[model samples]
Target: MANYQEHAFTHSGLLADIPVTLLAKPADLTAMISRFGNLGDAIDACEYWYGPYPYDRVGYVLTTDGALEIPTNVAYPQFMTTQTTGNNRGLYTHELGHHWWGDKVTPYVHNDMWLKEGPAEYSGHLIEEWIGGQAGLLQAVKDNHFRVLREAHLDDGGFQPLSPMPDEHIYGTHTYYKGASVMHNLRGYLGDELFRQGMRGVQIALAEQTMTPQQFRDSLESATGVDLDAFFDAWVFAPGYSVFVVRERTVNAVNDSFEVVLNIDQKLRGTTVYHEAVPLEVSFLNAEGEEFLADIVASGANALHTVMVPFEPALVVLNRHNRLNQARTANERTLIPGVSFGSTQPFVDMIMYQTNLVDTTLVRIEHIWSGAGVDPATPDVIDVSDTHYWDIGGLWPEGTILRGRFTYAGATADNLDNALVDGDETGMLMVHRETPLDPWAPYPDQTVLAGDLANGNGIVNLDVMRKGQYAFAKSSVNVGMAEVRTDLATVDLFPVPAMDHVNVQLDGGLNGTVRFDVLNAAGQLQMRTFRSANAEGRYRLDVADLAPGAYLLHTAIGEGTAVVARPFTVTR
Candidate 1:
């Protein structure tokens, strides 16, 4: 039997452990421990800012069905798992953060849900960053952005006032992503330490009590010792995102640096003017691979400023992380090589996956290409001449390989001509000829005449294709294969730089059973496995327990066997 009573004990500020009952089985003991540990970490994080844990005898229960329920005495979860992926851990962390931000410092009503939901959501993200790192945090933000953009209806007018409850369908947008975005903006405005202090103050003020959003705001102001009305008005109540465009840039020969200006535009669309300090990151890379970074702030629309940074950069990129949606003159450029026959299938697949589809009465085929990193001089080089969509030329950078498949109508030979390249145009295009599939391959005389579009003659149809059908593009590129050197020889692990979890696809090569171990930068082991004659397949290993820091996965197949090591990360 497991010590269920001890695991359920809630620690007060003074470290007093109260006896409690365990409402789970022995197999669930590990999960119970993890939950308690998370709860303890949340308590510590909150206390580091506020004061200390204010409650006693806190109970955590796992509910088989329904959403999470957080009461003053207990937290009942609708789901619990140690699988390391999905929203389960995040949801758990957010609910635990509510112990400090909502349950303790209660939000008076549902209208001011931001007070309860925003901080909690922000806390979950913070915890994710702690365990998953920068990539994980950025991915979480991206997921939130995508979710809100897909579900929320901006035309319904800017965010609904924090008083009336909006429809639950909009919950993911209004209460989660938008709310978290506001908190994130506020954190940027007040700085990390000050913002944390403000959070602590709010918790202390509402200890064992309830407060309105205004009261919480007042507490934050008092704690941070700064005014935040503008911050609140712009983020908490605003709709849509701020757009920043790179207007112009100039290089200074004397200093061997560049001066760039950014134009911030606001599309309020009849909404109140948003006034909040926005931080922007600018990056410039020179021909020699040298890079320089500069940070700037924009307080409102039409805010223009110039900053001089070291290095006569060949390319300048803004918002490198895509943190904000903006139209910039100097967006990142990509090289797309002209496509021809005998090109690598993976390369063709990549082009097809990236290209947008243009359909007309002429033909129907998939088009894949990338616009990012396109050379500005040749902004519209991939022109479709004599074609219905002549204006459909895509942006391509120098040295980029372009690959795609084209099927010509069997009866009508299409004239697919390659346009001549000029000084302004410097990229290759490779087009593959695909035969129409036979409805009955083994059956004789079972073929169909597929329509095709030729040079300036037949109609052409270009449709955006989905991914996964093509092979890995970079594999066949001249970029050279990635060097795989390992001190260990007997074990092999693939799919390096994986997202969620690392799969230990063991092959016991020559050596019998292998021992797999994953260690962090601090030389701390995260996971260990002992396999016997393992096949060449995926073996899931959870890395969510490990912090965002770097880690090494070492596999020892057998005696006199080689040890293979790989680096992997867990992204939320």
Candidate 2:
């Protein structure tokens, strides 16, 4: 009950020359607090970005549990209680931001909790990014995006609107992470200088008073002098993301000019479809391979447009900056030599998500196609590498399917880490089509696979993945099967492509103690359990909530000897 010593001390510091105190439990937190010093640097950073700190004295109460903001004093989790634990400076910065956000300028109504959490969250992100540069900011944003998507995935159906969200989902991703993400998106929409000016205006307008979503929007409009009603409607009030389907595009070279025709549709799923007001950037490379950029606003159904160019356009690129949270990422359509990879007609679309970090590169290749050939355990017909993220724009008379593959070379481990196609959450890695006549309903199981990622390889198959459909995938922790060494090798895991529940039976039971653990591809622990060896050595595990993907099963005996590990997959 008492392996560690717990003491308390009050350390005085200064932020902007204001008397600040950091009271830590276990006394050991003194070093961490001292190292981090006063909140001066963080406060200065925020002031430079956001406005001035509105509080008199900033004091932090460090406890081993819980975090809450209380006017002049704030309580934070004691993550800095031990030297072994890295200082949670991020958490400290985030809570500190609440003094200006949650306390000073609160939301007019509880429904608009985003005003508090979003600004605070974004502040911490901004501070860290300023200190650590682009990589840090990118990682922060990526983590935020992942959190939002994860929460959305776990949601009963999917993401709800940020504004007027159901009470149950009020504190969910839509309000916190998505709220911050939308702010970042706005920054992208409005150039940095303009966005910064608008932000300053918001802080000044809503200082020391509760504000509503409309009031906040009005502040931004007042500062930027640009109509943001559409922006707020699409990103804030709307419940779903934008889905742009390239119905058709034609490029013709006249005597002295080139004409381009584009037909796009914004047919999105969910109860509310976001009518985004974003610039569509189309790039054309002349015969000399020089690129020219053109911007336009294409909205509504079947947006037909014509572009005139003075030179011959060899290749065209659309939506280069990825300004939209597109349901489908594939924007270019291309020819794949002799491979019949796409649909006969443009029946499917590919949405790819890629991220590169130190020692890890993740690419999520997803195909949205329709047809009868769709099966759950769809074999890899096209290599993912062969497919491009371009919606070729109806260029092919006989369209083809897309394919690609991923290899683990120089990776830290062989395990394909946290990898999953959000659209195919079952980890089936098969083509998922929309329900016939019902966009909200699930498409019938085209085919059932034997297990989750049967071979443990980063391979994908979208057989009969029709044209003009939508699909998405992401790089989850990609990892391979972990190697296991044990005398009791007769462990049996059945229902390869497991559903509902998985059964485990061992021929040779451990005589001592036994434990079990499940890990996702990213090597993150998912589940843990303790089991006593019985006469039959049978274990039935429920897996209804586990997303579809490759997972590792670890069995440990007394003191870790005679340990065994196996790989298994899950499908919805």
Candidate 3:
């Protein structure tokens, strides 16, 4: 209205002509043009996928209130008119996309915000894919897939369904990112030509009219000629994503070919699995640097499937192209010390942190499965009722301590292949062991913290300074006396028989120097050593140097609580 500079640009549209112009302050004109430099490309790409622009004219208007899409006219904030690159172009395309998704084709109800914003956000991907090709689209979808997996459940306002969404979170992460993700995965599911036809039908046939979730589903079903009720019910109407675990993967070399059998299980969240309908891409890489892929389809429940390939594969990976929103970060990476680490498969809320030492370490976390690759040996104590396992590994420095707060399902358990026995949450114990050879024991210092238990959920805190292999079991144990420690605490140790190693069971809340001395029967000290520790874990003492005889183990912690002495025999 006052001193606004104008730059006019023109482009030919598929059906309607687009006379594009950029209007901004004199000082901001160059940056604005740079930001909207791809306006013509956006127009052509949108038309190529979504038909006409749906408006008689379109222009970029700079205003105090920017970043909103009006009918045929686009609003841009002067300050936000930065140069477009990488993903920045998406914003411009999204706002312009609203011309097709919302400005013309409106939502019948507020809950249908996904019908408007989802496609509009997806328009950016379409334009990106249209101009940059399939590689760009794959990258875009992968980014969204990982992002949704990382954030969909913990979004700002918390978890909510895409349809009939809570009024407050109508525009939350699930609506925009997950909605766009659904569209991307749907395109992959229904194939390009058919998916495009279905999408264009929604814009062209339902033009200038209001739409609902049901109406959108009907339009797509009519175009694709495929039933989508289960897909919509599981992905849109529900609150969680599909969780998959490679229960077991075995490769055997046949005559010039390889036979690969994948025992896969569909673990649930709040939603059910749709693996039967949706195709999961599995990639197999041979030692000759060649990669082959196969379409993996299974029931929503657990199953064992087999595939035959021409070449013996060295590695096998699933969902290589990022087709679903899942909680499994199958890839293993190092964890930094003192940093809070969570976001694991199956147990999303399980948190582990190292507090005793401050240095880089080789702690890596990977997938949690029914029985990916853990030994199934049981000791004298056996209670395998509804137990789920998640294993991670890293070396613990001399006295470093690692603590974890385990979060489990409450009632309608949605984790592993089988349900918790009786679906009861009480008496739930989270146990850990060093390896398949080691006996399962309550974490060195274990505490069953109060949690929502009656439903099928509970929490337990434990300090573990050892390599991985943790599980949740539905068994009754004296929670206080669940772990077996050597008779190194008191002069008379009865509950847990003493072993060679000095058991250091310290609570997760304490950090102190643990001192233990082996004294002869004459009250003369034979050997003494100390180690700094925190959380709850144990370490082995070298008794191989001592002569065979009986001795007293004097254990002490901090300043005041240094009064424990236990008698033990060193039979080296």
Candidate 4:
């Protein structure tokens, strides 16, 4: 036997043998004691609630190794202690709980292992509650419930019966999570005192001996004075679980309290639905700073229950104990929207418009606006005056449209105004004619548009034609506008080769309203017009769906244009 030691601790009374040889560092002495202190508290709580401690010596080891093993005694790794303090405490408590469920009354065969593991896991939560209050324990339980539901698979053909221990790393199933869930459900059925008594009775009856899986079940029945065969058969022997889909819920006021009625459906998929009643705790918080609690049991495929509680509830949350896995929750939020456009203008315009449509609470927008030589604030609007080109930069979901329109007026009949669009980094150009001009006409002479500028300069008036298909050129500028002659501004697209998404930064212009357009390899539009004002930030364009090819993104804010052309490939 190990040498035993007694010491005064904050959480529990009576400290047991300390095996210092297992501890590597001298500094770990205090930490080792602290860990054992928590373990002592758990043992005390379990004894007070259920029964007595069954171990003569508690062996605690701190190591950097990964696995948690029980070799005729309790063994814990040091990494657990340093990685997560709370998880370390819970793990120690759980392993210690095994002294009763696993070590004292061992499983004769590997199949009956859950009888040892499940109860010990549940005991860990109980200890967590004792140490860190009910709220902290409840949150831990909720996290575990979500993890189980998220990992469970409904298409794994055969169900893994809880009677036998399956390979731990098998795909589509996990033993520890399922076992813990089963024990939690049992606790709901037997009530706190009855469950504790049942566990203690099993430990005392089978003390210092090993039992088969069937024998463990028999002991549970004898201790609880109830038939749990059906419970075990459905939850333990069976595989898979039922997902509850809540269709609707209604709350009504009745006699100084509120009564809630919920319409729910169960989807068992390929598995048989178990006919069992599960306790659900409903919490309602009212605007008047009042809280109410109600308990209800859901048993049938289509179960309806009315829960009455004092005060009207502003918010309602179900499955407060995290005993059962739920498919739907009221707190779920919608995923981000994906939009596709057919043209660059429409795509850029859509992006700008949807910027406002997106829920501000969920997404944030950043952008930059730039144009040709004349500092975006003063863009030349004359025909072929490259000054009117605009570039808008920001991140948006793939296949989304960004749309925006700018107006320009001609200063003379010979000089016409036009709009040219292109991506910032790609340099792929798409030009559109602003006014109805004869396509066969000669190139227009030097003329100014309607904007505040020097004697030879021109301004782009906001008056735009609302009808007719505006002819636009792909990858080139259109020189067919009659009587329009102006110097085109030379803008360079940077960060040439981009993977996934590209960024556009405007160098010479005041930040103003900007728009974006995403085009596919074939120069076809996939999203509608998106727009944002004075926005400056990096924008991501998803090229995952696009084939191994090149794509273009055009950005424009006022008369400034920056084009970005990038090539990317999709790998499955």
Per TM-score, the best of the predicted structures is 3
Tell me how far the alpha carbon of residue 193 in candidate 2 is from the true structure, in angstroms, after superposition. 1.9
Query: What is the C-alpha lDDT profile of model 4 across 171-199, one tens digit per residue?
Result: 22345656677777676667677777787
Error of 4 at 269 (Å): 6.9
In candidate 1, stretches whose alpha carbon ends up further than 4 angstroms from where it belongs are: 1-22, 25-51, 64-73, 78-86, 154-172, 253-257, 267-276, 321-398, 402-572
Off by over 4 Å in 2: 1-21, 34-45, 80-89, 156-158, 245-247, 252-261, 267-269, 274-276, 280-294, 305-572
Report the lDDT of model 2 for residue 471: 27
Worst 10 residues of 1 by lDDT: 471-480
What TM-scores do the predictions have?
0.53, 0.55, 0.62, 0.52
Q: How much is the lDDT of residue 27 in candidate 3? A: 85
Error of 2 at 333 (Å): 18
Alpha-carbon deviation at 311 in model 2, angstroms: 7.4
Please give the ranking of all candidate structures by TM-score, highest first, separated by commas.
3, 2, 1, 4
**lDDT of candidates 1 onward, in order:** 0.46, 0.55, 0.63, 0.47
For candidate 1, write residues 1-572 as lDDT tens digits.
33333244544433444334324455665665655445545444445544555555445555555444364334444346454434555665676667777777776776667777777787766765666677666666655644443334442344454334365523545676667756766766676799888877777666888887667778889998988876666555554444443434555555555565545343332235555666677666665445687777767655666777676666555566544422111112232333222322221121222332222111112212111111121221333211100001222233222223322211222221222211111111211111111110111001111111122111111222211111100001111113333654534344455555566764433434444455666544444443444355345554544456566776554541345667666545
lDDT by residue for model 2 (377-487), tens: 223222121111222222223333333222211122222222222112222223233321212111111112212333333323222233232222221212222445756
Candidate No. with top lDDT: 3
Q: Give the worst 10-residue stretch by lDDT in candidate 3.
A: 475-484
